[model samples]
Target: MNVSITGLTKEYGKKKALDAITMQLEGNKIYGLLGRNGAGKTTLMQILAGQVMPDGGEVLIGGQKPFENQAITESICLINESENFKKGMKIGDIFKFAGYFYPNWSLETAEKLLEEFSLDKKMKVKSLSKGMESALGITVGLASRSPITIFDEPYIGLDAAARSRFYDLLLEEYEVQERTFILSTHLIDEVSRLLEEVLIVSDGKLLMQKNADELREESFIVNGPRSDVSAFTAGKNVIHRKAFGSMEQAVLYGESKSDARKAGLNVEHVPVQELMVYLTEKTKGGVSA
Candidate 1:
């Protein structure tokens, strides 16, 4: 289940969203897509899912083009943030429609999730609350059991408890049934633990790609005397730095484990969520998350 995207680019009039982006996503891995706003995460997902067309580049899923190919696209599910269910359609009707499109759709799992989320089937989509709408999308996404599952911030408007439920279910589904999962999100801290890989995009370009474990092992937070902390991270790419009184904390992105260890400073692994925040600072002039 390898998805190869080469030279992917998107433009809206004079503004470029994704500039010659290239990536290869292997099977059965959970990927965290991080970026600032306008970094083109949504555009990338939309193109991959065959919902939007890229101005240039090639997208190959399983060694074939995905655009306009139902056989391939049907196997890929994109649960986007803005899942607008029509006003007249009931929740059950939508589920029924999904069952027709996805051969691997699971009604039992869908029913259980519906009950857990307390979503009423008879209610109109327009009448449901924002959180409820998100829950409906999640239920369909999980039940689809598609080979490639891409979630674009599906937990928006969901409460903390609901979000936790989503995380648990996503992991459980992944463990029992190996599938490619790509998560584009702002809730990095909450979902970081589940990510096996991290892909960061900045200013419409691919900035970094690394194994989750390796990244955590290399990055750390250093706090000490101002001069000492600065000296510790003198040559490192400091994601963030702050000082209060004589004490200073500098978040350094080290390339090697030895670099972090030899610093001889207070060190803690970089939290994926926090790292995203620091790496994509507003002052850097791109997205917020």
Candidate 2:
């Protein structure tokens, strides 16, 4: 389903959690919702899921407001970082309830995932370890088959191997099912290849929303002598810069890779995770870059 947010604002006490954030997300594409802690990533996800109402503006799913709208909510599944399942419920009970709540819920997928994750249906939620609990959440989130699935740090306690399996399954599901997936994760580089587009939030504001490939192509690091680096980076958006003795390296946000090469500067692609860090640091004035 298509998601449209217009002037969305949320506040807690005197602080704004989200400030007039406006963006449109098309259906059936994977999106990376990225930001540091306290950057309003969670607030925006909650509001989008209809768990919290915005103080101003609106969120529309499939052209209808999702807040208190069962039709819209049924189509959206948001698996948060914590408090996903009740502590007292059995694993089987949780799956049963999920089947009823999500119209597109697939029992076959759920059962298969249970065996794949080595989760016993009789196991009570409280009895499961953190890794097991995360696996269960992943099972439900994927098997729920909601048109709009939002995973906010879904692999909290999962090991590297399990996480890799989850990534593979996610891509498989996306290709076959063709539904929207909104992923909020700090592990940007790991999932960067899977993201079609990215929405970056900073300090309760929308920083930038761009196609993932285009963003990567436009942003690069140039390295050369301090003077040459300085001249090449002049009149450009420099996200970060570092000096290595007489040599200097600067991260720039523009399509100037060829120009840098022409200027006898060494150019390298910046990983999405590093780019995010540099961008946020620049925004927060953590560095002079």
Candidate 3:
């Protein structure tokens, strides 16, 4: 389902969690929701999942409001870091509940994944380890098959091996059944290749949103003598800069490599993780798409 937010606002006393956010997310695509801590990533996802109400503005899922609307809420599934399942509940019980909740839930897929993750069906929530809990959540998320499925930092206690398994399963399922997946994660480099689009939020506001491929195409760093680098980056969108002795490196947006080479500057492509770090670092202002 397509997600449309118009002037969405949320507040807690004097702090604004979301500030006049406005954007339309296309359907059946993977989006990497990138942001630092307290940058409103959770708030925005909650608003989309109908777990939190906005003080102002509207969120429409498939042209219908999601807040307090079962029609839309039933089609969306959000798996967060803390699931808060009952301590006495068994893993199999949770799967049964998911089957009842999500219309598209698959019991076959759930059972297969439970074995794949080495999670016992009879194990209670409280008895499982942290990584096991995360694996259970991942199992439900993939088997649920909701039209709009969101994962908000869902790999908190997972080890590297298990995390790699999750990524492989996610890609395999997504290939078989295309759906809108919003992955709000801090491991940008780990999941960069899975994202079709990118959304960056900073300081409770939307900073930038663009096609992942296009963003990479336009992002690069220029390094050379301070004077040459400065002159080459003149009037350009400079997100980050560093200098040592007579040398300088400037991370720029939308500057041509040929232009930088013409000005006697060395150019290199900026990795997505590095670009995101420098773009959102200590910046309160928003960047247009």
Candidate 4:
């Protein structure tokens, strides 16, 4: 399920949430939809899921528009941070309703997940705890078996234990049957490992999109004596660097491991989160990227 979104924009009365964004998303991969608060992550996901219309531009899934079309809609599931569940409805009733709309819905998987989450079918929607409600939402996102499954902070109210379980299940399902998964969360450190590619958005605009591994590899961190580190970092495109007294650690790109070694200094693989912070931080002190 290849998705092509080009020149996408969303407009309110006086605001443009997403501005002329363009990207090509391949199928059967995990994408980390990263951004600061109010960076248009939800808007992009909503548009792609066909729940909202863009004021301009297009969203195509398998060469067809996604809005209001039953054929394409069937393959896309958008599990938002907060879902609109009927307060009067029971858990079983919700499942019955969803099963009809989703052709690939599995009764067996739904039942298994229900037990795992310790949810009772007779319980009213209003009676469930916040964590339980989140669990239910995740169950639908996974059990629906949609070609394009999106979780917009699906573990909002879940505890650390439950969230770990959800991640394990998600990876297991992904391994067995390849599906396109897009997860939007502020908990980058926890979920960063699962991302095949990272898309960073800031201030309602796309910042960068690159292979997770390649980005980490091409960039290296150097920590040692200030003079030695400065000399080693000379002529490199320094994204960021930091100094602690006489010692300095610099984060740099545009150089290979061999090149850093040839300069006679210590280099190590920088974690994705650390590299991201260095790249995005306003006060890098002109060093440590």
Q: Show where candidate 2 strays beyond 4 Å.
A: 282-289
Clashing pairs in 3: none
Better of 2 and 3 by TM-score: 2
- Compared with the true structure, all predictions reach lDDT values of 0.84, 0.89, 0.88, 0.83
| Model 3 lowest lDDT segment of ten | 280-289
Give the clash count for model 4: 7
lDDT of 2 by residue, 50-73 (tens): 889899998999999988988888
In Å, residue 287's CA in model 3 sits off its true spot by 3.4
169-213: candidate 4 lDDT, tens digit per residue:
899888867899999988877887899998876655677788888
Q: Is candidate 3 or candidate 4 better by lDDT?
A: 3
Q: On a 0 to 100 scale, what is the lDDT of residue 116 in model 3?
A: 94
Looking at model 4, residue 90 earns an lDDT score of 92
TM-score of each: 0.93, 0.97, 0.95, 0.91
Flag regions of model 1 displaced more than 4 Å: 256-263, 282-289
As a whole number from 0 to 100, the lDDT of residue 131 in candidate 3 is 81
Clashing pairs in 2: none
